[model samples]
Target: MKVSIKREFDFIEYEVDMSDATLLEILHEIKTNQENSLAYSSGCRSSVCGSCAVRVNEKEVLACSYKVQDGDRVEPLKNVEIIRDLVVNMDKALETNARAKSWLAEFNKETVLNHEDEKINALQSDCILCGSCYSACPVYAVNEEFLGPFSLTGVWKYVSDKRELNAAQKIETIQTNGVWDCTLCNECTLVCPQGISSKADIEKLRMKSSMAGYSDPNFGQSFGGGFGFDGTPSF
Candidate 1:
C-alpha cells in the first residue's frame, strides 16, 4: 500500500505491505523498515494518551486508532506548526488552555460531590486534550485568536461545576474569541474519539453568554446596512 505524508520537509510517499494494521502501525513500519529517520509521536497506544493525532484524508483522527487503508493520504494535524513528520507543536493549544483558564478556580477540597454532578462532570472531564477537535476546527483556520473547540469545552466543564461561583466570569471569558467565533460546524463533534460534543458544549456557552448580557457582536448589522440606494430600508 502507498501512503502520502505531508511532512515539513516535503510531501513524501511511502509504501508498506500490512494487513489489518492501524495508520500508526504503518507509520512505525515505514520508520523501522523503509526510512530510519522518519519521525512521529505516539504514547499509550490504546488511544488514551492522544499523542498520535493526525489527519487522514484531511480529517483529524487518532492514528493509533484509525485503520490504515491503501492509497491513504496521511498528513499532520492542521492549524498547527508541524514539528516533524506526523508530530505537531502543541504549544498553542497549551497556551490557549492557560488563557481560558480551563481549570477549576475556587473549590474546597474538603467538600464532597454528589453522584449526579460527578457523573455530569465525568462526561466532560474524560477529554484527553488530543487536539483533534482543535485541528478539525475551521474557525481557528481563519481566526487564530478564537479559542478552539477543546479549550471552550474545557471551559464549559469547569463553568458547569456546582462548586463554581464565577460562572459569570467564565462565561465572559468564553463570549470573546470563544463561543461567538464558532460557526457551529459540528466538525469537532464528529472527530472526537472520546465522544465529547464540543459543538454542543460551545452552544451551551453561547446561551450562557446571552443570559450574561453578551449578545452577538453583529446582531443587527448586515453587509451594507438596511438601506437600498432608492432610499428604501431593506430587510
Candidate 2:
C-alpha cells in the first residue's frame, strides 16, 4: 500500500508492505527501514499515553489505536508550529491548562461525598494531555488567546467537584477568553481518544457562568468591525 505524508514544504509518498498494520507501525517502518529522516511522536503503544496523536486523512487520531489502510494520508497535528515532519510543538497547547488555572486550589474536607461523587468529572479526568483535542479545536485557530477546550474541560471538572472550594472564583476567572469564546464547535469532542465531550463541558461552564451572574457581552450580537455589533448605530 502507498502512504502519503506531509512533511515541511513537501508531500512524501512511500509504498511499503505494511498490510493491516497500525498507522504507528507503518510510520515505524517508514522511519527505521526506508526513510531515516521521518519524524513523529509516540509513547505507550497501548494508547494510554496519547503521545501518538497525528492527522490521519485530515483527522486527529491516536496512531497507536488507528489501524492503517491502503493509501492513507498522514500529517502533523494542525494549528501549531511544526518543528519537524509529523512532530509539532505542543507547548502552546499545554500552556492553556496553566493559563486557565485548571487545577484544584483547595479541597473541602468538610464536604460530604457519595461513592459516585466524582462521576460528574470522570470524563474530564480521563484526558491524558495527548494534544488530540488541542489539534482538533477550531477556536484556537482564530483566537490565539482563547482558553481552549482542554482547559475548559478541566475547568468543568474542578468546578463540578463537590470537594472543590472556589467554584465562584473559577466561574469568574472564565468570564473572558474562556467559556464564552468557545463556539461549542464540537470539533474537540470528535477527536478525543478518551471520548471526552469538551463541547459539553464548555456548555456546563456557560451555564455555571450564567448562574454566577456572568454573561457573554457578545451574546446575540453580529460580528462587525471587530466588534459584536448587531447592525445598531452607536453614534
Candidate 3:
C-alpha cells in the first residue's frame, strides 16, 4: 500500500506492504527500513497510552489501533506546534487543564459517592489525553486561548463529583475563554477516542452557569443595537 506522511514543509510518500497492519506498524516499517530519520511518537502500542495519536486523512485517530489503508495521508495533530514529522508539542493543549482549574478544589469530607453518583462523571475519567478533540476543535483557529473540550470535560468531571467542595468556583473559572466560547460545533465529540461526549458535558456546564446566574458574554453583543423603545425596529 502507498502512504503519504506530512513533514514540516512537504508530504512524503512511501510504498509498503500493508497486510492488515496498523498505522503505527506502517510507521515502524518505514522508519526501520526506509528512512532512519523519520520521527513519530508511540507508547503502549495497544492504544492505552494515547501517545501515538495522528491524523489520517483529516480525521484524528490513534496510530496504535487504526489499520493502515492504501493512499492514506497521515499528518500530525493540528492546532499545535509540530516537533518533527508526526510528533507535535502538546504542552499548550495540556496546559488548559491548569488554566481552567480542572482539578479538585477542596474535598468534602462527608461526601461519599454511591454507584449512581459515580456514574455522573465516569465517562469523563476515560479521557486518555489523546488530544484528538483538541485537534478537531475549531475555536483554536481563531482563539487559541479558549479552554478546549477536554479541559471543559475535565472540569465537568470534578464539578459533578459529590466530593468536590468548590463546584461553583470551578464553574466561574470556565465563564470566559472556557465554556461560553465553545461554538458547540460537536467536532470535539466526534474525534474523541474514548467516546466521551464533551459537547454534552459543555452543555451541562452551560446549564450550571445559568443556574449560578452567569450568562453568555456574547449574548448581549449578538443582539446589540437593533431594537427601539417605541416598539419599532431601529435602523
Candidate 4:
C-alpha cells in the first residue's frame, strides 16, 4: 500500500509492505524503515489516549484505530499550529477550556448524582480531548478566537450539572466567542470520535441562555430593524 503524509510544506509518499495495517502502524513502518525524520504522535494504540489523531482525506480520525488504505493522504489536524509532520500544538485548542471556564465554579454543595441526573451530561463526559472537533469546526476558519466544539461541550458538561451554582455566569461567558458564534453546522459533531454531539450540546446551551435572559449578540444585527428593514408593510 502507498500512503502520502504531509510533512511541513510537502506531502511525502511512501510504500508499505503491509496491506492490513492501522494508519499509526503504517506511520511506524515508514518512520522506522523509510524515513527516520518522519514525525507523528501516538499513545495507547487502542484509541483511548486520543494522542494519535490525524486527518485522513480531510476527515479527522484517530490514527491508532483507523485502518489505512492505498493512496491515503494523511495530514495533521487544522486550526492549530503544526509543530511538525502530523504533530500539532494542542495548547491553543486547550486554552479554550480555560477561556470558556468550562469547569464547575462555585459548587452548590456536595451533591451525588442520581442515575437520572448523571445521564444529563453523560455523553459529554466522554470527551478524549483529541481535538478532532476543533479541526472540523468551520468557525475557526474566520474566527479563531471563537471557542470551538470540545470547549463548548465541556461547558455543557459543567453547566448542566445540578451542583454548579454559576451556570448563569458560564452562559454569559460564552455569549461572545462562545455559544452564539457557533454556526450550528454540525461539523464538530460529525468528527468527534466519542460520538459526543457538540452541536446538540451547543443548542442546549442556547436554550439555557434564553432561559437566563441572554440571546445571541448578533440577534439584533440580524433582526430588530438592524438589517435596514423598517417596520413597514412592503407588500
Candidate 5:
C-alpha cells in the first residue's frame, strides 16, 4: 500500500507491503523499517484513547481505528500545531477542555442522579479527548478559540447534570465560541469514532439556550433584516 504523510514543508510518500492494515500499523511500520525519524502519537491501540487522531484525505479519523488503503493522503489534524509528520500539539485542546470545565465543577458532593441522567452522562463521559472533533470542525478554521465540538459536548454533558447549580454560567460560557457558533454541519458527528454526535449534542445545547432566553449574537444585524424581508414575523 502507498500512503502520503504531510510534513511541515512537503508531502512524503511511502509504500509498505501490507495489503490490509490500519493506518497506525502502517505508520509504525514506516517508522520502524523505512524512516526512523517518522513520528506520530498513540496511546491505546483501541479507539478508547483518542491520542492517535489524524487527517486521512482531509477528514479527521482515529488513526488506530481507520483502515489504511492505497493512495491515502495522511496528514496531521488541522487547526493544531504540527509537532512532526502526522503528529500535532494537542496541549491546547486539553487546556480548552479544562477551561470549558467540561466536568462537574460545583455539584453537591452528596447528591445523586436518577438513572436516566446517569445513563446520558455516562454515554457522554466516554470522550477520550482525542481532538478529532477539533480537527473536523469548520469553526476552528476561522476562529481557533471557538471551543470545538468535543469541549462543547463536554459542556453539554455537565450542563445536563442533575446536580448542576449554574446551568446559566455553562450556557453563557458556551454562547460565544461554543455552541452558537457551530454551523451544525454534522462534520464532527461523521468523524467521531466514539459515535457521539457532538453536532446533535450542540443542537441540544442551543435548544437549552433558547429556553434560557439567549439568542444568537448575530441575531438581527444582517442585510436581509434591513431590507424588511427578514424571516422574523412582522410583529
Candidate 6:
C-alpha cells in the first residue's frame, strides 16, 4: 500500500506492505520506521477524543476509526492554520465559540431538568470538537467571522437548554455570521465522526430564529424584485 502525506512544501509518499490497518497506526509506522519528522495529532485512540482527525483522500475522517487503504492520500484539515505536517492550529476555528458566545448564558440554576430539552440537545452535545465540520464548511473558508458548524451546534444546544435564560441574546449573536451565513451544503453533517447533524442543528437554530422574529437577510437576493422579506413569492 502507498500512503501520501502532505507536508509544508509538498506531498510525500511511502510504500508499506500492509492491509486493513487504521490510518493512525499507519502514520505511527511511517513515523517510527520511515520518516522521523512526520507530525499528526491523536488522543483516546478510540475515536472518543476526536483528536485523530485528518483528511483521507480529501474527505475528513477520524484516523482512529478510518481504515487505511492502498494508495491513500492523507492531508491536513482545510480552513485551518497548519502548524506542521498534518497538525493544524485549531484555535481559529475554536475561537468562534467564544466570539459567538455559544456557551450557556446566565440560566436559572434552579431550573429542573427537562427530558424533552435533553432529547433536543442530545445530538448537539455529542460534538467532540474534532473540527472536521469546520474544515468541510465552505462558509468558514470565505467568512472567518461566520461561526462554524460545531459552534453553531453549541449555540443551538444552549438555546434549547432548559436552564438557559438568555435565549434572545444568543439568537441575536447568530443572526449575522451565524445561521444565515451557512450555505446549507450539508458538508459539515457529512464529515462529522460523531454522527451529530450540525446541519440539522443549524436548521433548528434557523427555525428558532424565525420564532424569535428573524429571517435570512439575503433572502431577497435570489428573487431580486417582487419578493418579500417573509420569503413569499408574489404573482
Give one digit per residue, the lDDT tens place, for model 2 in 9-76: 87889999867789999999999999999999988999898888899888999998899888889999
lDDT of 1 by residue, 107-172 (tens): 557667899878876878889888998888888988888889889988999888878767777776
For each candidate, give its TM-score against the true structure: 0.90, 0.91, 0.94, 0.93, 0.90, 0.92
Which segments of model 4 are wrong by more than 4 Å?
A: 224-235
**Clash pairs, model 4 backbone:** none
**Winner on TM-score (3 vs 5):** 3
Give the distance in Å from residue 51's predicted Cα in candidate 3 to where it truly belongs: 0.9
lDDT of 6 by residue, 135-190 (tens): 99998899888898999999989988979999989988888888888889999999
Supply candidate 3's per-residue lDDT for 81.
Answer: 90
- In candidate 4, what are the lDDT values of residues 1-235, reduced to their tens digit? 8899999899888998997899998999998999999999998998788999899999999999999989999999998899999999999899999999999988877887899999999999999999999998889767889998999999999999999988878987888788888999999889888999999999999898877766665665567655534322122
**Model 5 C-alpha lDDT versus the unseen true structure:** 0.83
Where does model 1 exceed 4 Å of error? Answer: 220-235
> Clashing residue pairs in candidate 1, if any?
none
Question: Which candidate would rank higher by lDDT, 3 or 4?
Answer: 3
Off by over 4 Å in 6: 220-235
| Reference-based lDDT, residue 198, model 4 | 95
For model 5, residues 1-235, the per-residue Cα lDDT tens digits are 7899988888899999997789999999999999999989998899888889998998888888899989999888888888888788988877878767787777877787888768976767888888888888888878988888889889989998978888778887777677777899998889888888998899999888877766565654455356543322232
